[model samples]
Target: MPLSINSIAPDFKAHTTEGMIQFHDWLGDSWCVLFSHPKDFTPVCTTEIGSVAKVKDEFDRRGVKLIGLSVDPVAEHMRWAGDILAATGQSPNFPMIGDPDLRIAKLFGMLPEDATGDSASRTAMDNATARTLFIIGPDKKIKLTVSYPMTTGRNFDEVLRVIDSLQLTARHQLATPANWISGEDVVIVPSVSDETARQRFPGGWESPVPYLRLVGMPS
Candidate 1:
């Protein structure tokens, strides 16, 4: 089954580039961005890791710890870390979990069993370790999950943007609009009844459409 939001995220102990780390124990109280790539030393994965390295500080500022996972061994991760530094001139400060046995992958439901008959395969597109992204809250719940094909590169900007939105929403009770961006006006979760709407949103509610109630305010 797919992992559910607002539920405790699956925990695990696995080998990583930085060494062994227990999921909840190591993650501490920080939000987490856990992603998986097809394998180490591939072209697309190389670029993806490089981009994430460049924005490492941004993630740090937002109190989000980044972790990477793949079915490759720790030795492969070490070699790839060298490659990433040589290619990008920056070492990965984050942990790259060495899931050669797919232990952590199975816990997080990263594997698409029916698609690949168990274990994430390098050949499958939607299933397997073919570039999966997950945003887990500090509360240990998964907030969002995204999967992509191995051939295409991930949208780094979108990842950061969504992180910003999620963080902001968590701190303040507000909702992000469609294609919502930082500094853009946020919508308030509306009440079902007209009387409740007036009580909760005293400023007044405008409905451009029946189901669409918008409140323009800073978040």
Candidate 2:
């Protein structure tokens, strides 16, 4: 079955550019962003990889770890680093998992269980469904999942914005509003009653409607 929000992220052992890793152990006590590409050396994904490298420090600032996956061997991923650097001037500074056998891809439900063959024999189209991103919390539960079509490049800035919102809302009983970014007013989740909200937001809140109470971003 496909993973959903709140599902415990599946754990696995794999060969990454950084060496062998047990997924859960590598992710101990931190948020994580695990994104995948259809293949190594692909155009759009190369730029995406470089983009992540450029923003890695921001992710680190937020206590989030970044990792990537591609449907190729680690050697190919290493070789592609040169291309990524040439194209975007930034090479990946994080581990990149090599899914040559599609083991991790199928385990994460990115590809069908019946999918077969090593990445060496498959074309990019054959692994198109592998383009997905997962955001996991410190508890190792998936907080979000996004799959992109092969032709589109992902907006990683929005990914950072979401991480900010996720971290904030997780710490407080609030829900971000549409197009919300950090430091903006947030809505009190409906489950938080007025009485509870009062105690939490003792300074006060703005209620344009009965249930749509808006309050400043909590520190």
Candidate 3:
């Protein structure tokens, strides 16, 4: 079955650029962004990896750990890091999981269980479905998932924005409006009755419509 939001992310043991890791154990108590690429040494993937490396500090500040996956061996990933550095001025600072056998990709629903072949013989198009990203919260449940095509590089800034909304909504009974960013006003979830909302937001809220109550983000 395809994984869904709120489902516990599948765990696996894999070889990474850093070393071997048991996925859930490596995640520990931090939020995590587990992004994958179809193959190593590809141009678009190289830039994507470098982009994450550049803004790694932003993720770190939000208590998010970043890990990458590619359908190639660790040695290949290491070699590709140099090219990534040369092209984008940043090499990946996080562990890059080597999914040469497609085990982790299959477990995470990024590939079919019947998918065949080792990374040695597979082209990027052969593993195209592996271009995916997952955001797992401290509770080990998936909070978000996104998949991009071979031609599109992801926008990590937008990922960060969603993380901000996820963290904020999780803490309070609120839901972010369209294109919401941090410090923007949010809507109280309908589950919170007006009486309860009054107690929660003693400062009051703006009700342009009965079902749409907007309140400033709480400190």
Candidate 4:
């Protein structure tokens, strides 16, 4: 089954660049972006990790912590991080979990069941990690998830944009519109009862259509 919002993210203990850590313990009091890539020391994964490292400050500003995972060893992570620092002039400030046994990968449903079975000769990733992105809210619930094809790189800008929107809507208790930007007006969720709607939106209630209600623009 696909993971959904409000589901408690599966917890796991794994090796990271900074040593061992339990998932929930590492995420204490901070929102988390738990992302899984197909493998490490590869082309697409290289670019993705570097981009995320570049945006570390933006995520920090929003009180979000990033944790990357894949079925690679701790040694590989150290070498790749060194290479990344040389190439991008920035060191990765986040934890990159080395899940060689697929222990954490399987728990989070990141390892594809049939991916290795279809190969002709040897299966390197029989229990390997898949390229997946999961956004966990501060409440430790899975908020959003994205699974991308191996050929494509994940979009960091889009992720940041969505995070911005989520944080804004969360603080305001209002619903975001079709292409809501930060500081833009938001739509309010109407009540099931007409009287309740009137009570919630008191100033001027006008229903252009049955399902659509227009109140004063948000201040």
Candidate 5:
């Protein structure tokens, strides 16, 4: 079965553009965004990778580390980075993992355990399901996951928005409402008792229903 939100993110070691990294060790005490592409040098994947590189600083400020995976080996990954740099004029600011053996892909359940091959012998169609994004929390559990079709480019901005929501909800006792952005009102987590709510939000909240208490973003 594919890994789901709240499940512990499986750890593995792999070669990357920067160097070798052991998944959980790289994540030590920080949130992480681990994204994957079917292969190196694909047009859509190129744009997606460049986009993530552009906003890497935004993720860093939010205490989130960014890592990418592609089924291609290190040499191909290096070659592709040249194309990525030439096309976008933005250097990839984060590591792109070289999963030539599909180890990480299988570990994350992005591919069948039976899937095999180095990028040389395999084509992008062979690993099409590998287009996925994973957000792991400091606790080492997956906070969110999104999988995309080969033709559809992943949205890093929406990913940033989700990170904002996840970080806020983790620190506060409230949940974001539909289309909620930072600075908007938040709903009380169902478990926070009315008595406890009174203690936490001394200013009180707007209760459309007894259970639907809406309050300002936490200080």
Candidate 6:
């Protein structure tokens, strides 16, 4: 089965633009946003990566590390970084894994277990499923995942917003509502009864319905 939310992000040692790294050791208790592109030097993927570099500090401020992947080798990845920088004015210095043998792709279930070929032999369509996003938490479990089609571009700003929600909820017994943003009211978890909610959020909450209690973000 494909990895699910709350599932442990399978660990592996792989080659990255920064150097070789064991996945979990590199993560090192920090939250991680690991996304993939079908191939390097593709137009859509290039733009998305450039955008991430521009917002790199926003990710750092939240204690989240951003990494990327493409089926190309690390050398090709190094070459592509130059084009990304020239086009976007910022280099995505984050470590991008080179899955030339497709081990990392298969390990993450982005390809069939029996899939074959090195980066040179594969077309972007052959590895199209490699386009995915995994938000892993400090516990090394996946918090969120998203996969994009070859034609569509990803909205990384939305990714940041969701990460904020995930981090806030991890630290409090709260959940975000539709269209929620930081500093907005969040709903008390259904598992936390009104009585318990009172103790944790002593300031009281707005209950539009008996089952729906909304309150400001807790300190």
Task: List TM-scores for all candidates, in order.
Answer: 0.84, 0.98, 0.99, 0.82, 0.96, 0.97
lDDT of 1 by residue, 101-187 (tens): 655676677665443332234443433354678889888888988888788888878988999888877875567788987887676
TM-score of model 6 (CA atoms):
0.97
Off by over 4 Å in 4: 112-129, 192-210, 213-219
Residue 215 miss distance in model 5 (angstroms): 0.6
Worst 10 residues of 4 by lDDT: 115-124
Q: List the residue pairs that clash in candidate 6.
A: none
Candidate 3, residues 84-155: lDDT per residue as tens digits? 999999988999999899889999999999998889988999999999999999999999999999999999
State each model's CA lDDT, in order.
Answer: 0.76, 0.95, 0.94, 0.74, 0.90, 0.92
TM-score of 4: 0.82
Runs in model 3 with CA error above 4 Å? Answer: none
Clashes (backbone N, CA, C under 3 Å), per candidate, total 0, 0, 0, 0, 0, 0
In lDDT terms, how accurate is model 4?
0.74
How well is each residue in 130-190 modelled by candidate 5, as lDDT tens digits? 9989999999999999899999998888998899999999988889999888889999999
Give residue 177's error in model 2 in angstroms.
0.4
Which should have the higher lDDT, number 1 or number 2? Answer: 2
lDDT score for residue 166 of model 2? 95
Q: Comparing candidate 2 with candidate 4, which one achieves the higher TM-score?
A: 2
Candidates 4 and 5 compared: the better one by TM-score is 5
Best by lDDT: 2
Q: Tell me the lDDT of candidate 2.
A: 0.95
Give Cα distance to truth, residue 129, candidate 5, Å.
Answer: 0.6
The C-alpha stretches of model 6 lying farther than 4 A from their native spots are: none
lDDT tens readout by residue for model 6, 48-159: 9999989999999999999898999999999999999888887876999999999988988888999888899999999999999999999999999888998998999999
The Cα error of candidate 1 at residue 108, in Å, is 1.9
Per-residue error for 165 in candidate 3, Å, reads 0.6
Pick the winner on lDDT between candidates 1 and 6: 6
The lDDT, on a scale of 0 to 1, for candidate 5 is 0.90
